[model samples]
Target: MALQFDATEYAARLDRLTARMRDDKLDALLLFAQESMYWLTGYDTFGYCFFQTLVVKVDGSMTLLTRSADLRQARHTSTIDDIVIWVDRVNADPTMDLKNMLSEMDLLGCRIGVEYDTHGMTGRVARLLDNQLTSFCQIIDASYLVGELRLVKSPAEIAHAERAAALADDALDAALPLIHAGGNEAAILAAMQGAVFAGGGDYPANEFIIGSGPDALLCRYKAGRRTLDAADQLTLEWAGVSAHYHAAMMRTVVIGEPSARHRELYAACFEAIKAIETVLRPGYTFGDVFETHARIMDERGLTRHRLNACGYSLGARFSPSWMEQQMFHTGNPQPILPDMTLFVHMIIMDSERNTAMTLGHTYLTTAEAPRALSRHPLDLIVK
Candidate 1:
């Protein structure tokens, strides 16, 4: 079995999920989030780009409805015994197959929860499910049900994250030396990802964001790569993944001697991260952390250059994004809890000066304080 955790751990996760289902008055939960399925039953697969769903009942029974490509995948990677394969054909609808499966489970006329916010559940597919099941069952949008449960990491999950963090640090170490004048962004990115894979780590959920010079001021990954200039700034953000768990890291490296402005911006961003770290303890709201970041950046007069949100939750995730549901932003009421993994990034993008400074690392929130996952120093990296 390719299951990462023991049977007992998976069972406990399912139990916790079913308990939440009962509390939400959900007779059955139709989960479309790959993260939810993987967290609950160790059902890891990249087959979620197509239509698929994991149905979990209040009685603790779970089943997966997926395409034929993932039939063996489900068997080898998950604890799910009853796996139904939805065939592919011209103009075939998988949602009808899902409706039939729900009916077979005696879910007709029952209150069902559906994960509407996930990538797996498209609007067209969702409408089809609603049309097919509306007469028999009440479909409730419980997008955050499993996600909320997964916010806090278990001991076993934390262990995987710690290993991933170490791998990320190693990746940075391998890539930093390559950030020289006339260096290739592609080569640096390749070295970074290669380090993670060679260390037995999995591919990250999203593409690594790598840029140099003017592109450094941008955050999102774009098409085409550039060669590093003699005196340019470069920014890299990538996560190390293990068992689908991710620990992300971000750093800005200067190819030549950094200017005074560069040092000042890096110092401000680093201080902002440090300020937030001090308050990342149990009983603090996520907003409190963002507020601290805001105060520090505002005090440094870099408010215009900083991002509105400083950080977000991190966990086992699939493609499109590595970020988890909860985020650290203004007015967020989500409380910081023990065992929650957070990726806090102090990003200061000054388009006016054509410079970018980002310092980010993953941390595990403990009862007392948040513990750093990446062992690398937070200071500005000038190559």
Candidate 2:
């Protein structure tokens, strides 16, 4: 079995979840997030795109309701012994199987928690689930329950994160040489991803953001690639993933002599990120971190180019995004806790000036100061 953690760690995590469940007065949790399942039981599979769920009873029993494809998957990758597979047929609604399973488990009238906010639970699946079990049980949105528990990394998880961070550094090493003038986006992307694979790392939760020329202003990955100009800027946001745990890094590399505006924006980003780090300790909140970035960017008159949110929590995540529920955004009262892996970015894109500058990296939060996961310096990459 490819269990990410040992038996004791899994047991401790189960205990923590059950304890949290008791505190929240929840009888069971319908964990729809694949990350939640992986964290709790080392259940790894991309089959979460289908109608699958892990039902966790507060009594410490866990049963995974998935398709036949993941039946052996659960057995091999997870500690979950009780695996039930729902038959697939035309117009099949797996929620019926879930409802029947819940009924058998005597969860029919209990206060059940459903992870409604995750991509694993689609609106169609959620609606079917609600119609099938809402009247049968007291269902509530407990999407963040497991997420909150997974926020603080355990010693074992941090080890994986550190390994992932090393792989990210390796990727950067592979990309730096190829990021100069006339560089091929395809080559750079492949080199970066290849470095991770060679280092025994897993595929990242999302596509690496790669754009050059005017596209360097983009923070998101899009179709089509272009060669780097003689004097161009390239932005990259990629992660090193190990056992699905991510340690992401972002940067904007200058192909030639950086323009005056590029230098200006880079200076602003550097200062903003450094200042934000000062408040990354446990005494502050996630909002405090973003406010720190906002204050610096606004004071420098770069507010329009700056992102509304500086960064977000990172963990073992599934497709569509690597960002966790907790984010560094204004009005978010989530406290900055130690052992949390966070990815804070400083993005400044001035389309008017046709320039871009981005600086970001993941950090493991500590009581005093957050420790940077990446060993790479935060200096502007001028090739």
Candidate 3:
């Protein structure tokens, strides 16, 4: 099996999960999140687009119900042995098969936890399961149960995150030189991805966010690309993924002499990130970090340019987004813990000036202080 971690590690994760299940009075957990399944049993596969589920009992036993296409995939990538392939045909119902599986495990009348918020559990499929099993079992939304458990990284997981961070730095190093006047955003993006793969890294959960000119002010990735002008700003947000673990980084580069506004905004962004680092230690709530960013930006009169949230937790994730559940935003009560990997981005987008200044990097929370995973300098790069 191509398990990402050792058998002992997988076993320990199962123990932790089952313990949580017992504490919640859950007889079984219906896992649909790829990240949760992978974290628990190293079951790595992209078959989540279709209907798939992993039934994990409180006794630490697991059975994967997937289409036949993923039967070998589950075997090769995960420690799960009892795999059941559900056929797709006209009038075929996988949920019925799932119900039978639960009945066989004596879970038909038990309290079951379901990952209702995951991409794998679509509304249609969830509704089908609910309609079929509501007469037999009690279904509860346990969406963030496993996600909460995964917030803090284990020692081995931290090692993978650190390796990913190094590759992220290397990607930035290789891509920076390509950000010259008249450079192509597509070409720079290609170089960035190539650098990560050349360093034995895997594709990130999401596409690399790369943009130039006015598009630089945007945060998310778009479909098209543009060419850099003689005097323009370019923003990049990408990650280095190793064994599906992610360490993301963001930077805004100037292709020509930066304006005075750019200098001032970049300075505020740098100071905001520095302030964030100080409060990222254990005992601090995720909200405290966002407060720090807000206070710094507010003090600089850049509130209009600031983002609603500063950062979020990072880990092995699937597509649609790389962000995890725990986020650095106002009113969030989640406390920072040691071994947690966070990506804090000080984003300052001045639409009035049509300029963007963003500086972000991943950090590993420690007892003393948060340690930066990337070795790159946080200064604004002006070419």
TM-score of candidate 2 relative to the true fold: 0.99
Q: Model 2 clash pairs?
A: none
Candidate 3 Cα deviation (angstroms), residue 371: 0.5
All candidates' lDDT scores? Answer: 0.92, 0.93, 0.92
Top lDDT model: 2
Per-residue C-alpha lDDT of model 3 across residues 25-97, encoded as one tens digit per residue: 9999999999999998888878999999999999988899999999989989999989998998998889999
- The estimated TM-scores of all candidates read 0.98, 0.99, 0.98
Task: Point out where model 1 deviates above 4 Å.
Answer: none
Candidate 2 per-residue lDDT, tens place, 55-143, comes to 99999998899999999889999999999999999999899999999999999799999999999988889889999997899998999
159-203 in candidate 1: lDDT tens per residue?
999999999999998998888998999999999999999999998
lDDT of 3: 0.92
Give the number of colliding residue pairs in candidate 2.
0
Overall local distance difference test of candidate 2: 0.93
Q: Answer with 1 or 3, whichever has the higher lDDT.
A: 3
- Badly placed stretches (over 4 Å) of model 3 are none
